[model samples]
Target: MLLLAECLNQQGKSTQAVPYLNQVRRRAGLANTTAASQAALTDVIAHERRVELAFENKRWLDLVRTGKAAEVMTAHGAKQKRKYSYILPQAYNITSNRLLFPIPQREITLNPQLTQNAGC
Candidate 1:
């Protein structure tokens, strides 16, 4: 189902992606997709991935792949800080430097030619 939706989304067929998206939503006891625009549908798919795959270790990768890690994480961090005083107020500041992870130190040590990613 998601494969079909992803294909349609990639083809700029967000309207057609609705059915497959809705299939996932319905199985999760959520309502059908009512997203009107491609961007909105894209948001729906991202959200669905977050909810459906929570704690499976894919959320961060998904957000990063979709170029939404910064925007989503910043808002999520702010909300967390606001809702819980115990939570640190400092939120994740997503920047270009953060888009990719630094090269592993072990790997870099093994290969002297390897350069560390910027802002590690």
Candidate 2:
């Protein structure tokens, strides 16, 4: 699951991730999603990543990269902080900045030439 998502991310194919992302759920016997239904492409991918790679705790960063961060944060993040609450965030509005990730601190330290991500 990680490999697939990483591959999608690395290849700049996150938008094309649903077919492969749903493949992750197929492992658990859920209905497999097709590119046609990837309508909620970003969310479906995020949810797929959530359980598909739950053991690795990859959803947080995945959400951020998919441009679903603020939507997830304000929606899911806020709910997560609520006591005993468990409301699912519908989905964040998608935009351009959703694709890139913040460079690692170590990498930035080693290369002053690198710039911090547009949004942190």
Candidate 3:
């Protein structure tokens, strides 16, 4: 139910997603928030998902599946660079090609038709 709500919200159907999100809030014993706009609702959903699923190793996959990898990671990278001078600027350069896993060299060698993902 939570995942369905998130998918609907991410796809710009926040109105339709609200009921599912509310259901999740009720189950989790959290209060449902009233967002003024679609974007706000989307943010609320993302925040809930982040906190609810913390330390379960789901964040990166969620960001990538929702097509928010580049935008979120780029901003995170900038913040880290500013907060810690030792952090390299290029450490989190999240280009579109970097959103996917690269094909293994062994797999590609075994299958001539297989090609590596971009930015591998």
Alpha-carbon RMSD of each model: 3.0, 7.4, 2.5
Q: Name model 2 segments beyond 4 Å from true.
A: 1-22, 34-38, 80-120
Write candidate 3's Cα lDDT for 58-119 as tens digits.
99998998789899999999999999999986799988888889998999999999989988
Pairs that collide, model 3: none
State candidate 2's TM-score.
0.48
Candidate 1 residue lDDT tens string, 32-120: 88888887777778778878888899888887887878988889888877888897655466677888888999999999999998899
Assess candidate 2 and give its lDDT. Answer: 0.61
lDDT (tens digit, per residue) of candidate 2 on 1-120: 645655664566765555566666777798866434334454465566676677786766676655666665666545555644454444433345555677898999999998888765
What are the clashing pairs of model 1?
none
2 in model 3: Cα distance from truth in Å? 1.2
Q: Tell how far residue 34 is off in model 1, in angstroms.
A: 3.0
The candidate, 2 or 3, that scores higher on lDDT is: 3
Q: TM-score, each model?
A: 0.69, 0.48, 0.77
Off by over 4 Å in 1: 83-91, 105-113
Worst 10 residues of 2 by lDDT: 85-94
> How well does candidate 3 score on lDDT at residue 72?
92
The window of 10 residues in a row where model 1 has the poorest summed lDDT is 87-96
TM-score of 1: 0.69
